[model samples]
Target: MRILIAGAGIAGLTTALSLHAAGLDEIRLVDAAPEIRPLGAGINLLPNAVRELADLGLDAAVGAAAVPTTELVYFSRHGDVIWREPRGRAAGHRWPQLSVHRGHLQMVLLAAAEERLGRGCVRADARVTDFCRLPTGRVRVTLAHRTGDTSTTTEVDALIGADGIRSGVRRVLFPDEGPPVWQRQVVWRGITKIPPFADGRSMFVGGDSTWKVVAYPIAPLPDAAGLVDTNWAVSRTFVPGEVVDRAGWDRVVDPAKLLAALDGWVFDSLDVGALIAAAAPFEQAMVDRDPLPRWTFGPVTLVGDAAHAMCPMGSNGTTQAIIDARALASAVAVEPDISTAFVAYERDRRERMTLLQNCNRALGPEVVVAMADRARSVIRPGPSARDLDRELAEISRRYAELGGFDVAAANAASSYSVRRRPHSARPAQQPAGS
Candidate 1:
């Protein structure tokens, strides 16, 4: 079936790749960016996402570009250890949790998509402006090209909106849904070349609900100075009545300001302040929208952040998008019609993504840090250390299960890949390199 995907970011590109694997090869991806550049900070790919990549024959390439995180540790504001657990393969999962630069990961996916979907499959400086469901059971999509004072249109069997939080398709679907709802927090993110800490392959989160610092090594190896490229993020919830500069949310801020905000966040091995001070940082308001009742609308549908933009409380945003691509592609391959495929895809994904949206809003596994902080209070009798650990472990376990990354579940889960249908629309085209 002919398909047009809006936004060539991770979600859209992955969707194209997944569709190609499922024998639905007539696809095109249009992006709003003037050019595809390697940009952005680090992102963590939990084992579930990695497993999908493995099925797509991309595991080795992505693993080579990332550091396979071995563990995750939580610390109180005072630097006291709250809880610690193994991760990825160390946690006995079939795949590894990968930490890589966000831009690098996108480029990796883009390369794979181009090789498999043909070089002409993606176009830059073009974006989806609007769409209409034609009577012929197809969707006619309008595209606004950046080059000329012109616009173009095309009809496709299906249209997938993989654009991010401020998706144009989403805007058309819910024109009244204004800007994304801010989560009342401002985050500063950056990467720095620093001497590896804590086994050099682990991630850590410190502080409480109001504020926290997270850091992990995103590079697979240290440089000549024995320093690894590390990614760090510092976030603070806004105080009541504090003014928010929404217009300046995407601006780059001075590292000194970040250091000031994270003052005194020093640990025995990790110094949050020092990390921020050493890197150039970009700041943004942590924002997401309420989950919609449905993501499929006739011949059109949404995926990734467009479908359910959730806070990154548990590092499941990217993973969920990858999963969405797989599920949607699998449905398209097996379902008889585009509308049926979209419905099946939505049925399979909507409930779980909605749960994740609420879960992240509640801080997901990071809730453990706040729980530990409360337990450490001297104002009243706190839960015993043993009891606290049990509770914290349970919270983490629930979140893992909720996010579809539970070790047992992920390892034993059926594959998302699908066999090419016997009655495909046409024979698969030769991949670019092949």
Candidate 2:
């Protein structure tokens, strides 16, 4: 079957790989970008995502570019430790959680897709305008070049919109849905050189209202330096009806304002002020969205951010997209009828995706504030280690259960036996600078 996938980001690339693995041929993937470049900052790969990557034989490539996160440390505004717990392999999961630059992840996926699927399978610089279903059951996709000098049309057995939050296909299918509902939160993220604090793999710190930060080491510095290239995001609630200044997307922020937001927050050991200061002129924003009821329409379906773009609170965006790619691919492999395959994919994914979206929204505020409160009193010097351990264990268990990682299903879907080894072998190297 010939398939047209829109967007070349994580979702789109994964979709291509999954379909190919399912024995589908004649795949055409398109992206609006004139050329693929390293974009975005950093991403946390949960165990579920790691399993999918492992299935694709890209685990080593991803691991080489990532810092194996050992623990998640929660803090209060005053630099108090609220809670800390092991992550990924250390947390008893079979797979390890990874922290890596978003660009690095995208590049890894793109390179793998292009190499295995062939260059002709992926197309960049083509922006899909819309798609229409033919009476004969085939789908016709219309695309135009941003340069305004070129246009093309393609007929495919199916279409998948992995186009991201501002997806054109979604608007075309659900016009009455209007614009995405803002979750009243703005976020800013960037990467910078910084010395590793505590365990280098730790994520989340400085839980406080108005200001909070999630930080992790993405890759080691290039010179084998002690400092790791860290990534972080700071977010706050947006005022009602505030007009977002598009020009200010990359605006530098005042360190004082950023620090003041966490003034009395009590989290863990990390210095909130020092970290924010280190993240000078931080990129900022208010962003999030309400859940969508459906992600599939006829033969065209949505995946990843396009289907359910929520706040980055729960490291589920990328994981959900990867899962979607696998699930949709599996459905198509089983159901010969394109329409039946699309319907089956949506029926299985929409509920889970919606649940994840709601979970992220519910956890957003607590991530920044609850940990702050816990940090205020939990990490004091000379505390009872037994008591602290118990508290930390409870928090870890609660979060693990609430995170919606269906261990049974994840394990079943993540059978590595189904994956083929890469054609070329390479030695595993330490993250950039080690």
Write the residue-wise lDDT of candidate 2 on 27-61 in tens digits.
77999889888898888888888888888889899
State the weakest 10-residue window (summed lDDT) of model 2.
Answer: 425-434
TM-score of each: 0.94, 0.85
Q: For candidate 1, what is the TM-score?
A: 0.94
Model 2 misplaced stretches (Cα beyond 4 Å): 220-222, 238-247, 250-257, 260-269, 280-284, 364-368, 371-434
Candidate 1, 1-434: lDDT as tens digits: 78899989889988999888888778999998888888788899999999888888888988887999999999888888888899999999999999988898898899998999999889888888898776566778898887885799998877899999989998888889899998889888888898898899989998876788889999999999999999988888777798876654788888887666576786558888778888878889899989998788876789999999999888898889999999998888887666777788999999989999998887778988877777674223446777787888899899999888999888975467767666644212221110
Distance from true position, residue 383, model 1, in Å?
5.7
Q: In angstroms, how far off is 301's CA in candidate 2?
A: 0.5
| Per-candidate alpha-carbon RMSD to the true structure | 4.5, 8.0
lDDT of candidates 1 onward, in order: 0.85, 0.71
lDDT of 2 at 129: 87
Residue 138 of candidate 2: its Cα lDDT?
68
